[model samples]
Target: MSDVAVCSVVSHKFVPAQGMPVPGQVPASARAPRNDALRCTACSMRAICMPQGLTSDELKRMESLICPSRTIKQGETIYRANDSFQNIYAVRAGSFKTVVMHRDGGEQVTGFHLAGDSLGFDGVSSGHHSCDAVALEDSKVCIIPFHLLEAMCREVKAVQQHLHRMMGGEIVRESSQMMLLGTMSAEQRVATFLLNLSDRLRMRGYSPTEFHLRMTREEIGSYLGIKLETVSRMLSRFQRDGLVDIRGKDIRILDHEGLVRV
Candidate 1:
């Protein structure tokens, strides 16, 4: 098995679940199936994950079980570091970044979770989040009771499989970051990060190679473990080489192949 597979296996070993009712909280109106959801309802990610396996009837039943929440605004704290963990947060729309504070009071971004991504899962074991989750833009999310999900996993084979896959994907992404940090040069790291971001943007129905940077250069440097000046210099170099064009935060990839060449 590859290192990526190993990471997945390790992550799944700790199935984080906390604050779920023992028997599960069945909303009084949750008798019907959630199959007939014509629209995504509250979740933006329904197109990618939910509403696919469900029928109208199933959806109707599930709708009663679902509770929708308001969208989080940009720069708002979804949850602070060490906050009590109660629910599993699934990104219904927009984006968020998980961050940790350094001893000197600086912030280090741990991960960015975009639309359709999930956060707060790692907190299940400790009952408190180790990092802060903040919204990058106004975002919506579904809050599923953690214990309910865990209980459902016991009898629902499909839910179990879905959890497995999601956790596995998280492992792969985290491992890739570790590898990139350990082995890549500063330029390689920045290029690879852009490519990864572009791919994720494409997956979410956007222009992969052409988009405005939502996070600032300072934030990008924090994410990449580099200095702001270094990031600026790299972008200038890329522009000179015609690998990418940058005007303010707007970036256009002129030569994807050239950017990838190490």
Candidate 2:
């Protein structure tokens, strides 16, 4: 596998094309229904987004750089490998999985993105996406125009620093995944995966001990570099050992400490 690096600094300015809707305006077709309206300033996930720590005035400026949130239905492609890298998306709802295609026609599951996660940084260096991002469920994402965001980053130190940190996070995550695949036992890998998911969900205010699996056993196995059969067996073993309760996709951790010691 080629080593993945943090996205390069994109330095460009954006100009609206004639006949195009100005940035940040929600088209009627793209707008969520009244009860499910999307607004960055009012969003509960704002703290986890790029706009975190901005003043009210700065936030308004930040909002002007983003297009209205759009939805991706289940099984839909959010972006394909080699697609033009114009924008990075912030997940507003639901989840997605990113896969990298190989020369042999096989694909590797690279990462799973949940609400508040950013996508498209992998495209910055080559000016095209490095992998395919697909919706795991019906999802919504706020589009941040790359050029405009780059310009804003120049003037907003916090925004620039935050973006750097986000990029660094991607590198760290990939490194950890490599370690998991190279050294961990099947049971250890499975346990670590569950704990990681639990921590992420907890950060989003969901119950740490219980949640539904968004990906299938096969997907989990692929991400962990294990066989699908092994994935199933480990999960069953965990349940038998009273480490967790699994009824289909829903899982409740019965002993978080036991899982940590797997």
- Candidate number achieving the greatest TM-score relative to the actual structure: 2
**Cα-based lDDT for every prediction:** 0.67, 0.77
Q: What's the CA error at residue 179 for candidate 2, in Å?
A: 0.9
User: Candidate 1 lDDT (Cα, whole model)?
Assistant: 0.67
Candidate 2 displacement at residue 31 in angstroms: 18
Count: clashes, candidate 2: 0
lDDT of 2 by residue, 15-126 (tens): 3334324345433323322223566767878888755678877776777666667777677766788777777889998988888777986667888888989999999999
* Model 2: ten consecutive residues of lowest lDDT: 1-10
Task: Report the lDDT tens digits of candidate 1 across residue range 1-262.
Answer: 0010000001111122342222345543244433443335644466654534655654454454544444676777667777777667777777777778889878887787777777787677798888877776667766666666666567656567777877787688778778887888889978887888888778778799898776777777777888989989999999998899898988999898888894
Error of 1 at 252 (Å): 1.2
TM-score of each: 0.81, 0.86
Please state the error at residue 137 of candidate 2 in Å.
0.4
Maximum-lDDT candidate: 2
